[model samples]
Target: MNSIRFTKWLFSTLLFISVAVSSCQKDDNVKSMDSNKSIAAADSASTMGVINTPGNFLAGKGTLKITIEDSTYTFDAATDSVAFINVHSGDSKYFGITAINKAHTMSFGISSVGFAATNVNSKVAGSQFLFKLDEKNPVVQYTLTKYGGKDDSGKISIEKYNNDNLIAKGTFFTFLAKDDKVNSPFYRVEGSFELQLK
Candidate 1:
């Protein structure tokens, strides 16, 4: 009778210890999994925060503003018409941004070739900038051509590009000539634009 009692007690004690250990291990594993999931969530949130900033044009309507010499021209989605063009032809790609004021008399345009979505935050060379103060009058047109000498050339830098949303934001600076003469007067033009691709 004494030997049987001792054997039963030993078996019960061993079973209790085994069960306790197994439960502890399971708890540890669950804690580790939870920690990893939290870390991944934090990383994802930070990445999105960096990509989507405040006042992002891709989130809504677009805007365009340019300064020509002493005059500043502004176009907004609320009152003006802003548009973007993306074209692929052969081995090259073309990107353009155009804006017209509500009055329909003033317009601004910039065009570049060989720039793609991968060119974000990088300067795109050989861009042409055009500003027309009077659409019906040819004399009021100003243009910056790629062949217009070093001082007359310009660059366009795209700050953000969203291929999924078909939106882009960029800035440009150029020296536009009123005429093709070497001694002709030129206006310093600088501006920024945000538009959805059409």
Candidate 2:
């Protein structure tokens, strides 16, 4: 009878030990799941960074126009004909200006006119990607290459003053792009604009 009691007590102790170990395993699993959830939340929050808003600007469409003078023409070996030398100013309606990293990107079109030819109704769509502007002077340089010709580039210097009650503005610049067969037969163009933001 003493041996039988000892055996029963031993069996009971073993069952209690098993139950304790299982409980500890379940608690560890719960803690692991909670830790994983916290890590996921922290990663999601860190991925969203700060975003800055740009200031309001005017629509430059139909707000400015440019005209060229002293365009020259020549013959080309590629076309095998006297292809009239010309420059196409893109349509202003499709032009755009945007601010990027303290600088401005001025993308616009030029109307190309053939030298010594009747006025044509077609204008080429061209763009300049990067234009550097100083916050103080805000002078911008525009450059673009002829579709199948040489590189044409120029500069524009703009000055402005901002006050609480009044604002003063000034702009003056010239840009030229030309297609040359031998020495670059091209045209010179200029733009002028005056605006008052109230």
Candidate 3:
């Protein structure tokens, strides 16, 4: 009787071990397959001209293109609150505009900054405002010819918003004019940008 009991207990233990081992192997296989799929998707995006990057901005018109060195958002260190994106040059010239919108659906707060339209004839919606600045007198300003955002305020429209890739692309017909505050208004600006603000 004792011997029979020992055999039964050993058989049950072996069965449990086999089941656990098989499950582990299957899990590893699934993980490997998922990882491979991710790599393949990445390769396809680059090869197919899918532009997705944290540093992506392009807008121009005619022969002139706004010289954009970088784009960044600032936050107040003390309050941990949103500040602004600096599109300014070293000069104090007004090359950028700043405003706020708390209900920006772009996941970009302030659903596009409010454009007073005194500077632009059309409606405005962007994370940041673009313009030109006078390097010398530091009192000149320019509006946008081409702009980008995840809204419908601008003349341009959002062609695609890839949720899977977190990319927002659009077109715009920007018309940069100098505000009355400056010595004179700048030329009409126009262009398009396909920024991947992931």
Candidate 4:
């Protein structure tokens, strides 16, 4: 009889412990669900200004043709060749540029040109231009033109970029007369062109 009574007490104790553990597990699940909801709500509230939507003009992919006036001076105190221009077109802009022939100019007495000094690894702060949308290393072509009895050539390139909060960025190339043919005492004639979107 004593043995049977002891068996019944053991069974009752195990049943009570199981019921308590199940109640605690249900409470933990409820707390986890509440935490997830709060995080989602905070994320939605953070991106409220300047373009929260993902499919705006700065979201989709498109091409724009921007034209900008050259704004630099040469040794003769005259407006130098248009190197890089920033044309702000809502969808497009015009870069007031001329084309140059690279093969012919290099064949002549002109010196070879190179890119400007800028950090390409990081994005420019608060910029509105996409310089290398299609490719960072742009392939450019030039065509020669006659200006003021001087045999001059123009260089040009086109670039593309994805949609972002800021405008696009790009770089252009120009090879000026580097020899005594320029008739200027200062033999330093080097410049570059740039395009930006705003």
Candidate 5:
């Protein structure tokens, strides 16, 4: 009876040890899988010009899309370019963004002051929108100016801004008047842009 009891105790001990070892291995596997997932997420964000951490900026090509009246124009990183320029003269600072098509005949531009990450979802001050078509012959142009009459109104809302990266994503809607006149013919313009400042 004593020997039998001893054997039973030994068997129970072995069983307990086996389960503990297996549980530890399973937990290790779960930890490893979590680590791999984190790495994958970081890689994905970097590819899209997004940084998960604060104060880090990633530079990447951007896209722009604008619709004038019923005609839509799309410009991508390929065969086109988006430029963001910071102009500073005297005590004034201006932010300018331009998107040009591959053919170089069509372009859209914006100029604003006090446009920054802090101004997200707010209309920028001194904002102006300009659209140019057929740059070669006479340059057909439309504009939305800040102080224009009620008919010539527009707003630019910054949806996303990464100050460290100087990357801005925004949406704009405007009634662009020919020759910047309130009584002139106008076209409804709507667009979105993602730009990396130079």
Candidate 6:
């Protein structure tokens, strides 16, 4: 009888131990799941940083500040933006600034296949990345090449480009330009802006 009681007690103790262990394992799983959710929430909050917060740019020496409606084309225009790295329309890396009405499009580009982003120098006569401008009026195209006595020139700086935000800041000093349908002159196209990429 004593042996029987001992066996019964042992079985009860084992059952209790099993239940306690199972409960602990369940709690651990729940804690892990909660941690994962918190991490996901944090990641979502930092995506692309901010939007519509257009930065400020000061037109330097030779550039003219052209204003249209409410925004200035040279600075603080809602149309200014940065592009993804090597992820452009067909697989190109570019930075562009445009007029609010989408009438003017100025872009800088470099072929990323065998080029380093750090080597993009507009000041160099034969820069790896070239500057090109396209405007309405049946969309006249202008390049940074030299004209009568002026040449397009500038510099680009990537302040911070990451999962959080992208910033391609720079200054430009271009000149009187001529194309098939456009004859435009620039005193200097110098400005610097900081904002996230679209």
Highest lDDT among the candidates is held by which one?
1
Q: What would the TM-score be for candidate 1 when compared with the true structure?
A: 0.56
Q: Write the per-residue lDDT of candidate 1 for residues 36-154, one digit (tens) a residue.
A: 33443455432443212232221125678788778877776444545454434456455556555555555555655555464554333223234444557563667653335654456
Worst 10 residues of 2 by lDDT: 75-84
State each model's CA lDDT, in order.
0.51, 0.27, 0.28, 0.24, 0.50, 0.30
- Tens digits of per-residue lDDT for model 4, 1-198: 653343233323222222222222222233443553343234432133212222111101112232222433211101111112222224422222221111112111111122212332221111111122134565321211122133233333324322232222333333332222335222112233332212
TM-score of 4: 0.19
- Determine which window of 10 residues in candidate 3 has minimal summed lDDT: 56-65
Query: Candidate 2: deviation at residue 51, Å?
Result: 15
lDDT (C-alpha) at residue 87 in model 4: 27
Error of 3 at 48 (Å): 38
Q: Which is the winner by TM-score between candidate 5 and candidate 6?
A: 5
Off by over 4 Å in 4: 1-93, 96-152, 176-182, 185-198
| 3 against 4, candidate with superior TM-score | 3
Model 6, 76-192: lDDT tens digits are: 323222222221223422333322211223332221122223335434221111223433344333333344243334444433333233444433333323332234552333344
Error of 2 at 95 (Å): 13
**What is candidate 2's lDDT per residue for 1-198, written digit by digit as tens?**
653353234333322322222222222133444553344334432133101011212211113334445421111111110001122124212111211211112223222222211122223333222233345655343333342334334333224322232122222233433322344434455553222222
Clashing pairs in 1: none
Judge candidate 5 against the unseen true structure and give its global Cα lDDT, from 0 to 1.
0.50
Candidate 6 lowest-lDDT run of ten? 55-64
Off by over 4 Å in 3: 1-136, 144-154, 181-186
The Cα error of candidate 5 at residue 122, in Å, is 4.7
The local lDDT score (0 to 100) that residue 196 gets in candidate 6 is 44
Ranking by lDDT: 1, 5, 6, 3, 2, 4
Candidate 3 per-residue C-alpha lDDT over 64-163 given as tens digits, one digit per residue, 9 for 90 to 100: 1122233333221111112112121233111111221122211111112222112223344322232223345443333332222233334534454333
Which structure among the candidates has the greatest TM-score?
1
What stretches of model 5 exceed 4 Å from their correct place? 1-60, 122-138, 145-148, 163-166, 196-198
Clashing pairs in 6: 62-187, 62-188, 63-188, 172-189
